[model samples]
Target: MNFSLVREMMRKDLQEVRKNGYVFYSLLLLPIMLVVISVIDSFAIALSSSGKASMLLPTFSTILVFIPAIITSLIGSTSVILEKNNHSLEPLLATPITDSELFAGKALAPLSIGILLSWLAFTLYMAIMDVLTYGHLGYFLFPTELTLVQMFFLAPVTGMLGTFLTLLVSSKMKDVRAAQQVSALVVLPLLLLIFLPIIASGSDLLINLLAGVGFLIAALAIFFVSVKAFRRETILISWGK
Candidate 1:
C-alpha cells in the first residue's frame, strides 16, 4: 500500500532479474534482433519492389511494436507464473503491500524493460534506415512524426497492459502451462496486426489513429477492472486450491 514500499519492491525485483544471466542476456539480445529484422526487411523491400522508400519506411517501422509485445507476453508472463508456481505469492501478499502495489511492482519491471527495449530497437532501426537512405541521421526520420511518436509512446502502454493482464490471468489460472497458452493467445491479435497485409502495404494514418484511440479506451477499461476486481480475496477465490 505504501508508495515507498512499492517502489522498493519494484527496484529489487528488477535488480534480481538483471542479476540473472539469462534474463540479462535475453534483454540485450531482444533489441538487437528487432534491429536486425527491421533492417533486413527494409533493405529487402527496398530492393525488391518498385515502391518509393517513403512508402516502405512506415511498414518497416511498424515491426517495432511487436518487439515489446513479444517480450512482455513471453518473458513477462512466464516469470509471473513461475513465481506463483514456486509459492512466492503468499509471502508477497503477506506484506503490507496492497494488491495494487504488489501488482504494480510485479508489472513495472517487465513493462519498463520491454518498453525501453522496444523504443531502443525502434530508434536503432530508424537510425540505420536513415543512414542508408539519406547518408545522415537526425532526431526525426519520417515525414509526419506521428507513427514514430506513437510507437514510442503507445507501444509501451500496450506492453504494460498486456503484461499486467497476463499476470492477472495467470494468478487466476494456477496452471502454468495453461497460463502460458492463454498468454500466447493474448498476442495473437497483435501478431495479426503485424502480419496483416493491409498494414504492410503502407501505414494507414486513419487506421493508426483509430487503433490508438481504441487502445486508450481499452486501457482505461482494464484499469477500472484491475482496480475494482483485482484483489487477494478475488485471486484466492478464483484460483486457490
Candidate 2:
C-alpha cells in the first residue's frame, strides 16, 4: 500500500470538501436539527400529559444513519463528477498509480466524512442524553451500546456506497444536473424505509438491516464497474465540451 499516496489523496480530498459549502452545511444541519429536536422533545415530554415521549427514540436513531448518506452523496459524487467531466481524470490516470489505488484514494473523502459525522453524532447524542437525563443517561437508554456501534460501522459503509454509486453515474454522464438527479434517486428507497413503517404502524429491524446489506452489495458492484470503466482514453473522449 502507498501510505504517502493515500495521505496525499486524503488531504487533497478534504481540501476539496471544504470548498463545497452546501455539502458541509447539509451535513451540519442533520446534527443541529437532531440536537434541537431532541432538546425540544425532551422538554415537551416532560411537560405534556401524554405518555408518547418514548416513541421519538426510533426516529432519532434512524437519523444517525440517514444523515451521513445524504451529505456524503452530495459532496463526494460532486467532486468525482467534476474531475471526470472536466477532463482532469485523464491526467490523474496518466500517473503511475494502479486503478485500485486510485479508487481507494478517491473513496477516502466520503468514507472519512461519513465516519466522522457518525462519531460526532454519537457524541452529541451522548452529551444530550446526559443533560436530558440529569446524568442518568445509562438508565434510560439501556442497550444503546449495540445500537451506537451499529451506527458507527454502518454510516461510513452507507456513505461510501452512495458516493461510489453516484460516481458511477457521474462518470458516464455528460450533464452534471442529470447525474445529480439520477444519483439522488438512490435515497428514495431509504426514505421509504424510514417512513413507510411509521405510517403502517409497525417497523422491523430485520427488514432495515437486510436493506442495508443489499445496498452494500450493490455499492461494491458499482465501484468495481466504475473502476473498470474509468480508463484515461474513455474519460478524455467523453468529458465536458
Candidate 3:
C-alpha cells in the first residue's frame, strides 16, 4: 500500500468533512450529548442507590460503547454517498491509488474520529462518575480494568466494524438515506452487549476479556470481507441508480 496516497486521500476527505457544516457539527455534537447523557444517568443511579450504581457500571459502559460506532456509521455512509453525489468519486478512482489504499484512506477519517470521540466520551464519563460518587464511594469509581478494555479495545473494534460496513453499504447503494438506514444495522451486535452485563456473572476481568476478544475477531472478519467486497468499478457503475 502507498502510505502517501492513503494519507492524501484521508487529508482530502477530512477537509471535505470539515467544509460540510452539518456533518462537522453533528460529529462534534453527538459525542458531547452522549457523554452528557451518561453523566446524567450515572448521577441518577447514584442518587437512587449508591450500591447498585457501581454494579450497573458494566451495563452502562456497554451501552456507552455504541455511541462511537453509531457516529462512525452515520458519518462514514454520508461521506461516501456525498462523494458520489458531488462527482468526486469517479475522478478519485481514476487515479493511480490502489483499491486497498483508497479503502484505507476512506475508512481512516471516520474511524479515527469515532475512536477519538469514543475515548473522550469514556474519559468524561469516568470523571463524572468519580466526582458524583466520591462522597459515597469515597474514591474514584471508574476506569475499572473492564471499563479500560471496553474503551480502548472493544470500542475501536466496534467503530471499525461500523465504518467498514457503512462504506460497503454506501458503495452498493445509490441513495444516502438508504445506505445509512442499512448501515445502522451494523451496531446491533454492540447494542446486544448491553444485555450481557445483566445476566453475566463472573469476574469483571474474565467477562471483559471474553467480550474484547470476541469483538476483535468480529472486527477483523468484517474488515477482510469489506476489503474483498469493495470494488471501485461497482461503485462507479452503481452511481445515481
Candidate 4:
C-alpha cells in the first residue's frame, strides 16, 4: 500500500544481502557463467555448422530464465533469517506498515534482482548470438518469440512466485539453512524448462505463450494468498517457540 515504505524495505533488504559478500557475489556468478558457456557452445557450433546458433537459443533461454528463479529463492530464503539473526525482524515487523506493504517490500527485492539478472543474461546472450550468427548468415537470429516470452514474461512471473512463496515460508522458520532447503523446491518444477530446446528448435510461440500466461496467473494467485495468510506473529513466534 505504501510505496515509499516498500521501497525503503527493499533497500534495507538489499543492503543486508550485500553484507554477506559470498552469497551476494554468488548471485552474480550464475548469469556470468551461463553467458560464458552459451558463447562457447554457440561458437563451437558456428565453427562446425556454419553459424546457425538458432538451435542453441532455447536451451540457453531456458537456462538464462532460471538465473532469476534461483536468485529469487536465494534472496527470499535469506531475508528473514538475516533479519532475525541481526535482531531486526521484530522491529521490522513492528514498523507502521500494513501486511500488504510489508509483504511487497519483502517480495520486491528478490523479484527485482531476479528480473535484472535474467535480463542481463538475455541481453548478453542475444548479443553474442547475433554476432556469431551474423558472421555467417549475414543476419541476426535472435529475439525469437520463445526467447522473448521466456525472458520477459515467464522469468519474471517465476521469480514473483518463487519470492512470494519462499519469503512466506521462510518467515515461519528460524533456520536459514532449512529455509533455503525448503524454498529450493520452488525451482524444481521449473527444471522442465530445460527441455524447451526440443520445442524451441521449432520456434514454438504457441507453447511459450501458453506457459507465460499460465505462470502469470499462478504468480498472482500465490502472491495474494501469501499476503492474506501473512501474520507478523508467525515471523517471530513460529512453532510456538
Candidate 5:
C-alpha cells in the first residue's frame, strides 16, 4: 500500500467531485433542510402537551443517519461513472498504481465526505434539540449516551457501507443511474431499523445496542468484501464496453 499514491488518488478524486456543481449544491442544502425540519418538529413538540419531545430524539438520530449515506451514494456512484464515461479511468489505471491503492483512493473521498457531513448534521440537530427543549425541560437534554454512541459509532459505519456499495455497483454497471439505484438497496435494512420501535418491541437501550453492533459488523464485512471483489481489470472491462 503506497500512502503517497493513495493520497494523490484521493486528491484527484476530490477535485473531480468538486467539479460537479450539483453535488456541491446538494451538500450545502442538506444540512439546512435538516435544521429546518428539526426546528419545526421542536416547535410542534413545544406546542403539544404530550411532553415527550425528548423521546423523538432517537427518531431524529435515525433520520440523520440516512443523510450522509444518501449524499455519499450519489457522489460516489457518480464519481466512478463519470470517470468511466469521460475516458479518464483507463488512463489512470494505466499508471503504475496498484489496484488496492487505486480503490482506497477512490473510496476515501466519498467515505470521508459522507462521514464528515453526517457528523456536522448530527451536531446541528443536537444543537437545535438542546436549544428548543432546554427551555421546556430545564436542562440540556441532548448528546445522551445513546445519541453519542449513534453519532460516533453507527454513523461512520453507515457512511462507509453506503460508499462501498455505491463504488461496487458503479464498477459493475455502465449506467450511472442503474448503479445508484442498485446501490441504494444497501440501506434498506437501515431504513427498516428506523422503524424498530414501532414494529419491534424492545427497550431503547436494547435497540440501540443491537443497532450499533449490527451496523459495525455489516460495515466491516462490506468494506472487506468490496476491497476483495473490486478488481481493476473487471472495472476496466465493464467500462470499456
Candidate 6:
C-alpha cells in the first residue's frame, strides 16, 4: 500500500469534511448532544436519587460505547456521495491512486473522527461517573477492563463495519442525504449485540464479546472484499443513472 497516497487522500477528505458546514455540523452535533444530554441527565438524577444513577450506567454506557460507530457511519456514508455531487470525485478517481489506497484514504477520516470524539466523550462521561458515584463507591470506577475493550477494540471495529457498509451503499447513491440515511442502519446490529449492561446481570458480557469479535472479523473481511469489489466504472454509471 502507498502510505503517501493514502495520507494524501485522507488529508484531502479531512479538509473537505471541515469545509462543508452542514456536513461538519451534522457529523459533530449528534455525538456531542448525546454525550451532553446523558451526562447532564445522570448528574440531575444523581442529585435527586443517588442510588438510581448507578442503575443508568449500563444502558447509558452501552449507548455511549457505540457513538463512534454512529459518527463513523454518518460521515462515511456521505463522504463519496457529497464529492460526487460536487463533481470533485471524478478528478480524484482519475488519479494514479489505486483502489485500495483510495479506499483506505476515504475510510481514515471518518474512522479517526469517530474514535476521537468517542474517547473525548468517554472521558467526560468518566468524570461525570466518578463524581456521581463518589458519594457511594468512594472512588472512580469507570474505564474498567470492559470499558477499555469497548472503546479501543469493539468501538473501532464497529465503526469500520459501518464505514465499509456505507461506502458500498454510497457507491450506488447520487444523493448524499439518502446515503447517510441508509448508513444509519449499520448501527443497529452493533447496538443489539453490545448492550453488556442493565440486562439484570453480566450475562450479556459473553454476547457483547462474541459480537465484538464478529464485528472485527466482518470489518476486516469487508474492507478487503470491498477493495476488490470496488468498481470505478460502476460508480460513474450509477451517478449517471
In terms of TM-score, which candidate is strongest?
3
Cα error, candidate 5, residue 144 (Å): 1.4
lDDT scores of the candidates, listed in order? 0.67, 0.62, 0.75, 0.75, 0.71, 0.72
Model 5 RMSD in angstroms: 2.8
| Clash pairs for candidate 2 | none
Clashes of 6: 0
Q: How accurate is candidate 1 locally (lDDT)?
A: 0.67
Cα RMSD of all models vs. native, in order, equals 3.3, 3.8, 2.6, 2.8, 2.8, 3.1
Which regions of candidate 5 fall more than 4 Å away from where they truly are? 185-203
Count of backbone collisions in candidate 5:
0
Worst 10 residues of 4 by lDDT: 190-199
What tens-digit string does per-residue lDDT give for candidate 2 at 1-241? 6867866777788887677787667777776776567556655654472345444343455556655666655665566557766667767778776666666677777667776877677667656655665443235642264345447555665676666766666667666676666667754365445445432432345655565676678778877887887555655666454
All candidates' TM-scores? 0.82, 0.75, 0.88, 0.86, 0.85, 0.83
Q: List runs of model 6 lying over 4 Å from the truth.
A: 40-59, 185-206
* Model 4: per-residue Cα lDDT over 106-205, one tens digit each: 8898889889988999889888888777777776788777788878887887787678767767766668777878777644454445435434544567
The best-first sequence of candidates by lDDT reads 3, 4, 6, 5, 1, 2
Clashing pairs in 3: none
Give a tens-digit lDDT track for model 5, residues 102-126: 8788888877777777788888888
Cα lDDT of model 2 overall? Answer: 0.62
Error of 1 at 237 (Å): 7.2
Model 2: lDDT of residue 62: 52
Clashing pairs in 4: none
